[model samples]
Target: MKKYNLYCIVLFLFIGAQAKAQYLQDYTGRPYYLKTNDGVQGNPLLTETWYTATVDFANGKTANAILNYNLRGDELLFKNPKDSAVLAFVEPVKSFSIKGIRLEESDQADITFASGFPAVDDQTNKTFYQVVGDGKIKLLRYYKKKVLESTEFSSQIVSRTLVTSNSYYLFANNQMVKIKPSQKTVLAAMNDKADKMQEYLKANKVDFKSDVALAKLFGYYNSL
Candidate 1:
């Protein structure tokens, strides 16, 4: 009876190990090529440099590796070792961080993050948002890529142009809201502090349309 029990224990351990292995293997995404265009404004990556990342899946499983994202295709690609294939994370990813950027998946199949604002709603839709600033109030940026076609006329010649548009968002009152990258819209969204914010912007010569400038504004607001 003792021998039989020992064998059973070993079998159980083996099964557990196999299950873990299977889980990892199942989440490995297949590789594919991304479509290219000529008029894309910036590099698809948030940063040109690669960074180590921790990817969390919807099933509560996590994986660690070097990762990069292509905004144009909304693809999360990773490589584990020095000589591994760079594959995309085809599975639904809850959130992941590369370098210092933390991105979360939204209900609309978008990625979002905490804007350091107070939660005011019970909505559970996960939207992808790029957290630009985190403090008492948070600044968020939403990136989107759309294929645009334009015709150019030259000396008896015609050509087509394709470009991508990048959008921005603001997180406040426990919600992520899209807004134009302009002073009026941004200040309106922050109506409670609009007057003060406007004064601060003018004092600091902040450019509301610039991502860097917007991040600086949020940082200053949190400081106050």
Candidate 2:
């Protein structure tokens, strides 16, 4: 009986490992290329023509993106922006930055990943991926370790945009709940602060030292 119980335990462990085996950091998949102009935006490009897709692995998630070339000879560029030392892969990749991969009943799979993710010094938590419908993924952006922006898609279709809190949420209700700036305004502020943060980091020679410095700058920027 003990031997049988041990066998069952091994089987369970094997099954658990297989279930997690779907995740891979770098991916390779069949390419589906579509034509596009030089600098067209994402949605318009999608409307214009179908783009190739490859698996991605980053931010502890698995996701897919439009591939620029065929899978066999194309290269993958992994840029974290925050960590230059993270190493970028320039190989013929079918997928880069893949985290979680799941298949639907129809055989279509959803891949999830995150990029340009900014977080605090400890890196305890940050925005991550959540699988949506078949072949759909979304970003679960977090602020103060709380989910803030949810960028979701369904079967490659835009589902919805949900903002969990206004800028007032940042102030802990101690300050007035002034009307939060528009999306453009907030983005501009963030961009400006990011630039300043970069400058500050380089000036202080502390770019990769810790993320808390950048986070403080972002907080100040949001207050403006």
Candidate 3:
């Protein structure tokens, strides 16, 4: 009898705790986003919390983030559930920062393309960026044939880097990842020009290494 009473007490406590605990909920205050293992076309379903977050896109599209998490302005991550038809929430990220691409010279052409970090399932904690579409810049994780997370780049930005092929991408991660050799060339040319200014410095050597003018020259060079 005592054992039964103890069991009852424990069960009651469990129920009470569950009632008080906060499960992940959608904007409607319902747990509609907790669909486990429900995915379409082999894409994983979104499931669980700590897997998505609210993100603000440059285009004014806001993903409440049922499965998507914005890693940055250029990168996004999504976590899919194990094996159900119902997917979890969606996540959107901005991961276009230039941290994953490498630059090379193509003598015949004006630009070159290189594969960048794969946009993996952010929910699964896999590779940095997993490729979903044709463009390296495309990192949209889909579910039920829907775009859960997408990377957006405006036309002006694309035009700046799309001179060559898509193997080249634009990133804004602030990692100092150089994506444009032409930009680098322009910077190098400016540096060379600054060095040549040494002749003027001989008579008016304003410490080109530390002077504001010299620094500005180098800064201008780097901007290219």
Whole-structure CA lDDT of model 3: 0.31
Model 3, residue 133: what's the lDDT? 20
Can you give the lDDT of residue 192 in candidate 1? 77
CA error at residue 66 for candidate 2, angstroms: 11
In TM-score terms, candidate 3 sits at 0.20
Error of 2 at 102 (Å): 22
Q: What is the per-residue lDDT of model 1 for residues 1-224, given as tens digits with 9 covering 90 to 100? A: 99999999999999999887956764577775655566444456544666776667777777776777665665667764646666777766777755554333221222233222333232233434566666665666555454554445555544443344445556665666666767777677667787788798778886665556777777777777
**What tens-digit string does per-residue lDDT give for candidate 3 at 44-71?**
2211233334433333444343333222
List TM-scores for all candidates, in order.
Answer: 0.55, 0.18, 0.20
Stretches of candidate 3 off by over 4 Å are 1-79, 84-91, 96-224
The candidate that achieves the highest lDDT relative to the unseen native structure: 1
- The global C-alpha lDDT for each of the candidates, from Candidate 1 onward, is 0.61, 0.32, 0.31
Per-residue C-alpha lDDT of model 2 across residues 91-179, encoded as one tens digit per residue? 23323322223221111133332223333332222222222111111112222212133335545543332122212112112221222
Give the range where candidate 2 is weakest over 10 consecutive residues by summed lDDT: 130-139
